[model samples]
Target chain A: MKAAAAARIMPALVWAAAALALWQSGAWLLQQRGVALASSKLPYPYLVAVALFRNAGSLLAEAAVTLLNACEGFLLGAAAGVALALFMSLSATMERIAAPYAVASQMVPILGLAPIVYAIFRDENTARVLIAGYISFFPVALHTLRGLQSVRQEDRDLLHVLACGRAASYRVLRLPAALPGMFTGLKAAAPLAVTGAILVELMGAQRGIGVLMLRHLYYGPTHAALFWCTVLLAAALGIAAYGITAALENTLLPWSRTSGRRQGRGLR
Target chain B: MSMPYSTSSARSGKEASGKVEAERASGVSEHVAVLVTVEATAEGALKGDGEAGAADAARQYGAADPTAEAEAGVELGAAAGAEVGAEASDASAAADDRNRTRTSPKAAPAEKGRFMQQGTAAWALPLGAGLALAAIWQAGLIHAVLGLAAYQLPLPSAIFRAAADNAGLLFRSAGYTLLEAAAGIAAGTLLGWLAAAMAAAMPRWGSGALLLAASLGAVPIVALAPIMNLWLGDGLASRAAVAAAATLAPMAIGSYRGLTSADSASMDLMNVLGAGAVPAFFKLRLPSSLPAMLTAFKISTAGGLIAAMVSEFFYSSRGLGYLLSNSVKIARMPLGWACIGAAAAAGIGMYMLVQAAERRLLLWHPEFRRRLS
Candidate 1:
């Protein structure tokens, strides 16, 4: 297994090394062609790295704000979705009443409502979070509803035979059964929350990663490298959030390991 | 489990012959077992199946007596008469409720399944809320709200009027935007799929190229737009190029995964059959990857529109995105909203088109069949 892993890793490592060499030589070739075009505004990768290091503090602060908003929105939306799923599960009438609204919410682009919510809320961070939350909530709700619904008949029968109350039945059967679906929703929504936060920030926010990117765009040259850096930072943040969600799924839903392994097999 | 045996004994006289009938039925048990296993596995993921089953059962029970003139009349009326339909549906539902309770003492699973049906039905509420909100805005409630704060959010009526009046221009611009989006998506999907194919075929150099594509994909549209604008000039071409660049990485990654991720057992079987790479890809890999490709296509469709809009924000003079930006600058809030609406409609239309195409192409896929059934 170790040997197989090493063999698999070898190709990727070689490819990376080759690409880096090519990139460096390409940069050198561009310099040979003309220093003006090569080094102007957006410099080579090395120069951008240097600029990123220099302005790390301010950029990191901005990134932190955006991260906070994304996290806040993801949590709130996920909780609300779970609550709504539970409520709908409690009664057929309530589920019927809520179904159309949920579909409409998912279909309509939440960005369209961002301006209105921002106008109403006034506070930039809060409004951004609200928009993110709104954007992120639907998937969670849909998935949780799915999860709640997926509780097996046999399990429910066992619970009934055990004379379990509603709360106990939910604790033992529904919640555990729903965990995989809920986590799937959470994983899907994580990157979307970041995207939503950025969209709100772009629409009208005083500070955050989106604001920083826009500012860099408008300012030009002086902040050109910084702009690319900010974008890279945002991408990294999205990837990180995705990783964290995956990690959480593994930690919180151990039973999903079997399904996850199957999925992984399918991937390979 | 005990109830089945008890019930069988209780009706022994009728059921003795019924046993003979049931044994004959059990002769087809293999087929039934396969169906039940499939249903059970499906039900594991999709709780909606139970309601759908109930709906099917209702339909069956209602339609069972084809020669019963009054029942047939009622059945026909159910389609055309809402009241009749509602009453019949209710009766069928009640029957289902009793059937469920009797057959499964633990009604929780079936009840929860009904929750999904209820959720789908509840879609009406949000539609109503949206309509009511629109009506309120039209009735000057929005103006009143804005007036309190001294802000100038355009009234819903005004926006509607603007949308109606500029319908032709909006449609034309929408067409142009849609064309660019479609063209960009096609180009991106082709390039991405080719890259994925090349990567999969030759993993030696493909990994690095894949990484480069991903990095390029990660580059924000705002940053990429200026470069593309420089390369293609401030025309629709630039915007299209931006959209293509934005969409490519996702498709590549998705397609690569779909194409190369064949089951080893399947791959081994193909190998044993002496299948060539091309045949293996077409027969084994391609079919297996259809769902992933569709997912990527859907993602790219949305991404392409966004890219076109963002690109147009910087550079073009035509298209809905240009109209939106121009309106924002001129403070024609209603017109801006109208443009936004038009763009959204176009985006949704594109998404629906892809979804429809997916249904046609992947009819055999479990997800597609599950949705349809």
Candidate 2:
């Protein structure tokens, strides 16, 4: 099993190394071609690495701001989503009326509301939290409901014959069954929440990596490495969000590790 | 555990504690046996009997019927209806409550698989919900709670008026954004499918590519937007590139999973038949992958539009994102809201179009083939 796992990941590691080498050489080639903004367009990987080290403190601080807001919004949205899912699970009528609207709303370009939300709140923190929460809501709600509903009729019947009431049935069977689904939703929503926070930051937030990103971009080619660093930090934040959720899944539901791993792949 | 179960069951008012006590004493061992069998069956079901499991789940939850009906009218009434034309505000919440009450009694019968009887009529509830939501916004309740003035969060009337006023410009901008979205989705899906095919064919190097694509999907569209703008220049191409990059990962991942997940039975049969990789892929894998590919396409459709719009938020002269940002900068809340409305319409329309195509293409697939009762 270990060997198979290593085989699966070995090529990806090799690909990462090849991609890094290609990036540096490609930047060099563009410079040789005398392309305008060549370095800015694709800065050398090492220069960006140096900038990353130099700005590590400030970047991490800004990222913390974004990450903190994202976490708050994620928890808020997750609670709301779970509540709604539970509400819908109470009656098929509620699900009938609500699920379509939930699915339809997701079809809309939700991130487009960042600017409007920012304008309305006129406070960066509020806007960031609101947008992140809103972004995370539907997936969590939908997936949680799907999970809750996935409890088999046989299990329900067993509990029923055992004369267990609804709450007991839920506590023993439904919630446990739903845990994997909830994690799937959380994993999907985590990065999106981060993205939503950064987007709000871009909409003229007071602080955060996004603000620094925009600031550095306006400063032009000289600040290109720092700009790239901010971008990388933003990407890292997204990955961190996902990683944290996956780790939570691992710790909380050890039995589901194999299935959860499979679902995690499907999620990407 | 037994004490709580007995008390809870007694409170449920279905049966008395004496009958519950009798059943509990007799059924405990049977319940353990049931659990054992359930675990075994669940493992078996997970192996390859997904359709059976889904059917069982749908039957249990009574979700299959209404879900089918909902999918048909979801784009029409749920999203576009909320935004297009709404004026009145009074008693909207009450109306919504009334709609809910009316639907529940009917929903009971519909759960028995009578949803087809209502057919197109099933949409009325969702439509009402949309209009009610719109009316609530028009009522300034949202503004009241947010403590924002009219200029900050425009009422539905103002938004509708703005949309009507700038009908020509909004439509044109929507078209431009839609063009970018469509082009990006097409190009990205094609590229992603090719990548998936490569990954399936060459497990060593191609899996790495798939991982790369997945990581790319995690990269914020905001970050990708500027880079693409720099590389491709701030034009239709740049936004489209961003959209393409945003969409590429899901398609690659989804289709790769699909291609590689062909049943071992079928694979062995192909091997016995001495079918080469290309032939096997074309005859078996490609057809099998349609569902996942279409699913990816649907997701990419939404992602593409968002990427195009968000990219436009940074550097663009036209498109809904530019219009939205520009309107907000000028404190034209109504106009910004109108842009959101247009984008919502476009998004819903494109989604419906893709869904219709999915239904058409996947008619042979078991999930779609099972007629909704």
Cα displacement (Å) at residue B325, model 2: 1.2
Q: What is the C-alpha RMSD of each candidate to the true structure, in Å?
A: 12.1, 17.0
What DockQ number belongs to candidate 1? 0.12
DockQ of each: 0.12, 0.22
Q: Cα lDDT for residue B157, model 1?
A: 74
TM-scores, all models, native as reference: 0.66, 0.73
Q: Per-residue lDDT for B143-242 in model 1, tens only?
A: 6765533234666778899999999999998898878877888898898888888777776556556655655565556556766764567877888888
Model 1 misplaced regions, further than 4 Å:
A1-42, A77-115, A134-189, A250-268, B1-130, B136-152, B194-219, B249-278
At residue B84, what lDDT does model 1 achieve? 30
In angstroms, give how far residue A239 of model 1 lies from its true place. Answer: 2.6
lDDT of 2 by residue, A27-84 (tens): 9999999999998999999999999998899999999999999999999888888888
Best by TM-score: 2
Cand. 1 Cα-lDDT: 0.66
Best of the candidates, DockQ: 2
- The 10 consecutive residues of candidate 1 chain A with the worst lDDT sum are A259-268
